[model samples]
Every structure is written in C-alpha cells, then in structure tokens.
Target: MSFISVNPESDFSIHNLPYGIFSTQANPKPRPGVAIGDYILDLSQVSKLFVGPLMRNEAEEVFNQTTLNKLMSLSYEAWHEARQTIQRLLSKHEGVLRDNSELRSTAFVLQRDATMHLPAQIGDYTDFFSSLEHAINGVKLFVDGDKALFPNWKYSPLGYHGRASSIVVSGSPIRRPNGQMRPIDDRPPVFGPCKLMDFEIEMAFFIGNTPNKNGDIVPIDEAHKHIFGMVLMNDWSARDIQKWEWIPLGPFLSKNLGTTISPWVVTMEALEPFKVVNVVQEPKPFPYLYHADNYNFNVNIAAAIKPDNGEASVVARTNLSHLYWTMKQMLAHHTITGCNLNAGDLMATGTISGPTPDSYGSMLELSWNGTKPLTLSDGSERKFLHDGDEVIFTAHSERDGCRVGFGECRGKLIPALAL
Candidate 1:
C-alpha cells in the first residue's frame, strides 16, 4: 500500500500506476508521469531511482523525453521492471519518497493542477471491426435486406489504416466536419457542415518495442509481447460522409476529422486481473488469426452525453470482452501480411457493442440510423450530436478490491468553421 491515501475505488491506486504525460504550473514542459491517488508522480524527477536490472540501461533517458515513444520502445521486461520499482518507492513502508520532504515536493504534482498531453507520438493508427454485436448492428442499419455479415467477416479481423495526425488528447474540442452529403433520394451531394455527427466508443492499444522486420510476421502466440497498453478512445464519425464515400474503399473524410483518447495508458500488466475468456469465434477462424488462449479484457466502459446547458446523461454501457476478435488476433492478422508496426503505433477495437441495446457503443447504433431518439436528462432528445454537445468515455476493471482505470476520453463538438 502507498503511504498516500487512495480511495478504495480510485482509478489511480498503487496497484494501477498507468503511464501518461503531464505538465504542471511549476514546469510547463510535458514529461512522463504516472497517476497515483489524486497526484501525478513525475517520472522525470524519479528517473535516477530506477536502478533495477531491467530499467537501469534506459531509465536515465526515458523520462526526460517529451513523449512516451522512447519509453514505449523498451521491452516488456523493462516496462515490468519499471512498474515494480515505482510501486516499491510509493509503498507505505518505503522511505525513498515519503520520508524525503524536498524530494516529495519536487516530484508529486496535484492532478487538478496538471495538464495532460498525448502519451505517445503515434506514427500510424489502425482501426479494427472486432465486435460481432457492433458489426451486426451496423450491417442491419446500413445493408438493404437479409444480407448482414459479409462472407469474410467470420474468417478474420477486418481493419483499415487510419490517419494518426488527427488523433488528439481528451478535452480537445472536436470541430464538426464539413463534407459532401446527399439528400433523402440520393440527389447530387452538397458540400457543407456534416449533419450526422457521431462518436464511436472504442479502446485502443499502443504497440511496444518488439522489432519485427518489414517483411516478417508477428506470430499469433507472440502478439501480446508487442502490445504495450490500452486507452479509451472516441473515433468521431460523420455518418453521412461515410455513407456517401464508403462504396469504393472505406472511411475517408468521415473519420479523419478528430479522434480523442484518454491520457493514461493502462499497461497489460495492470489489466491481467481482469482477463476473461474471449468471445467464441464461429465458423472457425483462419489459421493465421487463430489463438488458443483467451486475450479478452473485462473492462467496463461507459459513455455519456451533455448538452450545452444540460446535465450529463449516461448513454451506453459496454464491455471490451464483447468483442468477437481478440486484440491479439487483430495484431497477428495485421502482421500476417508483413505490415510492420512500430513502437507507439496505435491499434483500435472499433465500437465495442454488447448484445443489448443499452450496451450499444455509438450514437449511430443507439439512435438506430436516426429512427430512435435518445432523451437526455435536460429534456432534450438527440438523434445525433449537436454543436456544443460533449461526449465522455471512461473505463475500469475491478475485482477483489483492485481497480484499474483509464481516466476520461472527453470531447465537445464545436460548430464547423464558416464556409
């Protein structure tokens, strides 16, 4: 236990020291940090204390960097070593930090006074359609008749390369996209602000330091070692634009507008307690995507919407365990074709919707293609997000008095720029 008091339910307990980047008033430069209780423990200040065998070689330079990419480039054994060292320093009986008033004052920053930044310098981002429920719901709404799942849907994880440049930290305002959309009868597309603004509740994992040659495949059995951690994500969507341009390729301007993610990256080491049996794959997956062991997580994710002047109302509740394709399968499939992934590269599980309606992970699904309207606590009904509406996402996995959480993925819709 840490000397500092942490609420039993607090997301940043000593058991879960998620990594992030933060800047305090005293030092405005963003540097690596770890959340504990309600304080941000500046990893830069404690860099010298990382004398463990696994971290000794890299610790000196890892924390001084502005982004976490350098740290992320370290091996899993190194990451585990760093976590173990941190836990010991913060433990109740440890005199390393708690006993030293000057060191403690210089190292810990109050969470409220700190500003968080993107934890990694994401080079490439990929989004995968992994949830069976979400995929089925999307097909039901978009496909014309009895046809729902595509023939290849059951065989492998389907994914698309996304724009990494548009990914932003939580709290960044999302500008409503301006694009071309057609009318009810498929008239000529008109260019203007998007009418069908929506958010997809997702969870993304950061890649680790495993070096794979450009032409080498990352084996299914070894994918976990290449995965660093997970974070909550909101993949903002312009449904109308997606509908119009998705015939040939896939999502274009409809998705690249803005994607928000929580600051902290909850390491797989911290999430091991919440592991669950992965959703069963039907029709048997291809040999390339097959993994015998379960890679599913049991994180509880909840999302809410708040109008400009209204109270926030919970919109959806879901779990990552609902995904039909495990993240390891996605990673394995990604590299099966010899596509190399670098450290800090992001991979997202697209819209994790559960079996029930309340477990829907996106407004597009919850509103059912605008046929259903969701009522907020402010007596406002919404089919899709309006300007000034804020969407918030949060997640945690708890068992036996231990809880690990990704703080919040929040973004407000700002009106499109005058065009």
Candidate 2:
C-alpha cells in the first residue's frame, strides 16, 4: 500500500519494517536503516521525519549513531512512536517523503548495495534450553532410561552464559574449533580439530534500554518492555568436544567458537499479530514466572544445508510455539537472583524442536547422534557438517498473505587451524 514497488512475496513488506545497521560503498560509515522492499530507508537521512511527540527532538541524534544501542535504550513508548511515525511517512497517502525527489534519493538505498553490521554491541549473551521436545530428545539419547527428564528442567528455565565477543552477524565464515575430545571410552582425550561440527537453530531477542538494578528482579508482566526485537541465530556446536567437557560445567569452547545471527531485528510490535498459545507446562512454574497473556509467537523456523557446489535443501522445521518456556519467563527467572540486565544484552531460545523427527532443531537430534544420516538432493549424506557445508537458519510468520520474517542467518564452516 506504500509508494514503493514491493513484491507481494517480499519479506520486507510495509508491515514489517525491521531495523539494522548498514553502510554503502560511497559512505562507508555505518548508520541505522529500516528494511522496506528492496531498499533500506536510511534513518540518518530522514531523521527529521520522526516528528512524533516522543521522538521529535531525539530522533536526529539517535539515528545518527553507528550502532543501535542508543536507540534501543529509549523508552518503549518512544520505540512505538518511532514505528508509527515511520509507517506514516512511508504511506502512499503521505506526500512528505513520497513526493520529495531530493530527499528520496538520499533517504533510500538499494539493499543489494548495502553491507550489514551487528545491530548493537552485545555486552552479554545467554542461551536457554526452553524447548520440551529438544530436551526430551537429549535425555533419551544421552541419559539413563530411568530419568526421562532432568528434575530441575521442569521447575524452571535452564540456561547458560554465552560468549558475546564471538557472536557475529550472518554470512560470516565459521572456523571449526580445535579442542580436546575423548573419542574412545577408556582412552585419554586427544586434542585436534572438531570431528562432529553441528548447527543449532535458534532465535534471540535484544534487551531494550531499560535496565534493572543489581538487586531488583524484573517482573514477568514487565519483561516485554525490556525486550526490543528478535533475530534468527545459528549456535554452531562442536559436539564431540562438548560431550567430553560438559559434565559438572556447561558449554564452554564448544559453543563459543562462533554464533551467527541475522542482520535485521524484527520488532515485537510487528510480530504482535502472530502470537499464539504457549506450550502447556505440566507442574506449573512458580507464581513469579506466570503470565496470563500469550507470549509465544507462531513463527515457522527452518534450517537448510547447502554444499559448496550443491543446491540448498531444508532439513528441519519447527515452530516457536513448541518452546515450553516463554521469553518473559526466561527473563523473570534470569533476574530472580537479582542479576542485572543491560540494554544490549541478548537471550536466545536454544534449539527449538517439535514433536516429529523432521522438526528436530540440531544435528545431534536430527541424525540421532550420527546413527541416522540425512541424504541431500545431490546424493550426499551428512551425519555432521563438512568443511565446505553452509548452514542457514530462517524464521517467519505469515497470515492472510502478510508475512513478518527474519531473513537468513547463514554461516559456512571452514577447516580448523592445524594443532
């Protein structure tokens, strides 16, 4: 409905004006931009268009920054007002931007000519095991038959602190990590390149400018205000190394090697219409982690693998609704002990899996720990990722011909350095 010529099937529709940091060849300085159709609406050039009460004077300064941290630190009301002002300015009926020839030339840049960077400087990252099916699969594959699920898993959301410095924007090359692994049961661990490299399909949210005091907990009802938006993530795993090291302690080098994330961050307001019922929790969590409103989004998440010379083929598909714990619950539980959260912090839903084999989220679950291999269109079989394999993660929700999507989170695995 806008003045732009957006294809109906394009993910960057007027309804989904996702934000990211980008730069062009002429001006190499990174700046904030909003994706629309095939072009990026340069916020730096059109900052004055945000004339809403909340963003009137602040927009020009915030949009000029190289990173999104300052903008994300604003109040939730200010964020909402920014979106409203943008939607109005881009509307077909609005002559302010639609008819301004000089402004249009400066305010819009073709997406293909732009280079993307990380939206914010993430201070910390947390990865949560919130999917019931993925957890059950792990228990079945690795634990004794008597313990179907970990006792603490049902009581609360389980998570681990992740390395923020290693997290990279999509399309970055992932170097296979070298670490010690006990390949044989009784043999001493050997140090070498990872043999079982894998990918984990996930989605993460960036914390807003709102920060809690060190000794105060963010209530479940108020967690939404602290969340800014979501992005697709690929938590690359070194399975053999992880199994050897993760015992009393959780993931370390096996997880920190490199995590890939999509460039654009799809805001909560754009995805509001896709909210669906959450997975039912059996024992029911504590009162502090409960919320009457539905926070689970009905996003269709899928993973595909492409060999260096072959076509991409989808291997797994799942929905965000399958996650047993909501983002609100995760945030509430995270700060229950009075741990603080900052504006650019990230929290991810780990390996979202559903009830079927094809819905599994990671290579460990999809191939049943290498017992069953997946055959691709080129007749190549994969139990784990190869040196030239590229893993791609995508997520989107569509209704009534309208789609809100996080574009591809992609990474190509390369050989590790010689030990």
Candidate 3:
C-alpha cells in the first residue's frame, strides 16, 4: 500500500508506478517523474534515495535527464532494480520517503500544475499490422473479398518505417494535412484538405537497453528484455491519399502528417498480471518467431469522439489479445535482416480491430469505406473525421480489483493551412 491514498479505480496506484517526463510552471525544465495517485513523484528531487546496488552509481544521471533515453540505455538489471526501489519508497508500511516530511514536499508535485512531455526522444518509428481481424476487414474493402489476406502476411509480420519527426505527445492538435487525391475515375489529381481523415486506435512499445549493432540479430527469447513499456497511440490517416500512392511503395504523405502517443509509459512488469493466452497462429510461424509461453496481455482499448462543443460518444472497443503476431515475433523479425534498433525506438501495433463490427478500430472499417455512417448517441453521424473533432484512445488491464492503465492518447483535428 502507498502512503498516499489512491482511488481503487485510479490507474496510478502503488502497483503501477508508470514513468513520464513533465515540467511544472515553477520548474520549466522537463525531468523524469513517476505517477502516484494524483501527484507526480519528481525523480529529479529524490534521485539520492535510489541508493540500491543497481542504481547507486547512475541515479542522478538517469533521473535528471530531460528524456527517458539515457535511463532506457541502461542494463535490464538496473531497470528492474529501480522499479523495486521506487515501490519500496512509496510503500506505507515502511520506507524513508514515506516517513520523511521534508523530502516528500520537495519530491511530490500536483499533477494538475505540471505539463506532460514526450517521455522519450524517439529516434525511429515503425508501424506493424499485427491484428488479423484488422487486416481482413481492411483488405476486404480495398481488395477482392475472397483474397483478403495476402500470401506473405501469415508468414511474417508486415510493417513500414514511419516518420519519427511527426510524433507528438497527447493533447497536441493534429492539423488536417493537404494532399493529392483523385475524386473520380480518369480525373486529374487535386491537392487540397484531406477529405477522408481517420483515427487509428493502436498501442506502441518503447525500446530500452543498449542498441544492437548493424549486423546483430536479437533472438525471440531475449526480446522481452529489450522492451521497456507501452503507450496508447493514435495514428492519423488520410484514406484518399493512401489509395492513390500505395501501389509500388508504401505510405508517404498519407501517414507522415501526425501520430499521437500518451505521455506515461506503463512498464511490462506492471501488466504481467493481465497476461492471457496468445492467439493461435495458423500454419505455425517459423522457428525464429516461436515462443512457448503466452506473451499476450488482456488490455482493453477503447476510442471516443467528441465533436465541436459536444458530448463524447464511445466509438469502438477492442483488446490486445486479438493480435495474431506476438510482440516478440515482431521484434525478432525486425532484426532478422541485420537491421539495428536503438533505445527510444517505437514499434506500434497498427489498428487493433477485433472480431465484431462494433469492435472495429478505425472509421474506414466501421463505416465500410463510407458505404454507411456511424451513428453517435447525440443523434450525430460520421463517416470520416471533420475539423475540430477530437479522438481519444485509452487502455487498461483489470485483474484482482487493480487497474493499470495508459492514461489517454487524445488529439483534436484542426483545419489544414492554406496553400
């Protein structure tokens, strides 16, 4: 139990001390912090207490860094030990931090007064289409119904390199991009505001530990040690632009506009209690991608939409367990070709739609390529997002009356700038 009283339903309980970067008005520089109830434990002010054997040497540097990359580059043993130290310090039963009044005042800051920043300085980003249902639903709309799944899809994880420069922390505005799209068959392409803007509900994991060399391939069994934690993600899309440019090469302007991620990174250790059986893979993946134990977590993800000055309407609900390719498999496949991965690199699970229509993760699938319109609770309809529409994505795992969650990934769509 923590010395601080936390609501039973709050995501920042003693069991879930997720980390982030924040800056208060009084202290304008971003620093490392841990979430506890309604307050933020400023690691910058309490770095001295991390005197455990694993972190005594580097506590100050790790906690004082503006971004999490420095801490993430440390050894896995260090990461594990740091979490243990933090848990003990916050424990109500016994600990120096819980009993010391002066230290507590300096280390704890109210959440409302702090501005959250991107937890890590992402060097690169990759988006993976790991959900089987999402692929099938999307393929059926763009390709022949009988040939939904591509032949190469089941063999390996499919992904594309994405723009790291466009990733923004939650609460940032996503300006609708102006791009080229053909309105009719045999018509000239016109450049204007994106007409088919959409939001993709997804989850992304951060890389920790030292990076591999250009030729080193990380095995599947050792992949978990390299993963630091997860955050909710919303990959904004322009459907019309994607259709025109995705013939020989993959996404370009259609996806590079913007992507949003939650500030806090919920550690994998905190979500261990919610682990569920992995989805059954057909034809059995190659030996390199196989893992005997289940790697799937039963995290419930949902999306909501709020129009200009209107009440929020729940749009979709899905789960991470619905993913066909496990995270370990994706990591192993990523390096099999001798590619290197660096600390703070992000890998995302592209739109995680489940088996049912109501569980679809994007408007393109929920509305069936604009053939139908999604009806909201307030007697409103939407086939594609409009300017001033805010999309919010949230995720959590509940077990034994404890809920650990990635707070929220939210962004509002603003009008595109004039050409």
Instruction: Name the best candidate (by lDDT).
Output: 2
lDDT tens digits, residue span 1-419, model 3: 89988998888998889999999989999999999999999999989888889899899999999999998988888988999988988999766878789988989998998999999999999999999988998778766677858888999999999999999999999999999998684999888989999999999999888758899988999998899999999999999998778767888999999999999999999988999999989889998999998899999999999998998899899999899998888888999988999999999988899999989999999999898899877788999998999999888899888889888899999999999
List the candidate 1 regions with Cα displacement exceeding 4 Å. none
Candidate 1 per-residue lDDT over residues 65-101, each given as its tens digit: 9999998889888989999999999999999999999
lDDT of each: 0.92, 0.93, 0.91
- Global fold similarity of model 1 (TM-score): 0.98
- Native-vs-model 2 lDDT? 0.93
Model 3 clash pairs are none
| TM-score of candidate 2 on Cα atoms, chains taken together | 0.99
> Candidate 2 residues 1-419, lDDT tens each?
77988988788888999999999999999999999999999999989878888899899999999989988999999999999888888899999999999999999999999999999999999999999999999888666546778889989999999999999999999999999999986999999999999999899999985769899999998999989999999999999999899898989989999999999999999999999987888888899998888999999998999999889989999998899999999999999999999888999999899999999999999999999999988999999999999998888899998888888899999999987
lDDT of 1 at 412: 98
Tell me how far candidate 2 lies from the true structure as C-alpha RMSD in angstroms.
0.9
Query: What TM-scores do the predictions have?
Result: 0.98, 0.99, 0.98
Better of 2 and 3 by lDDT: 2
Worst 10 residues of 1 by lDDT: 139-148
Candidate 2 Cα errors over 4 Å, as ranges: none
What residue pairs clash in candidate 1, if any at all? Answer: none
RMSD, every candidate, angstroms: 1.0, 0.9, 1.0
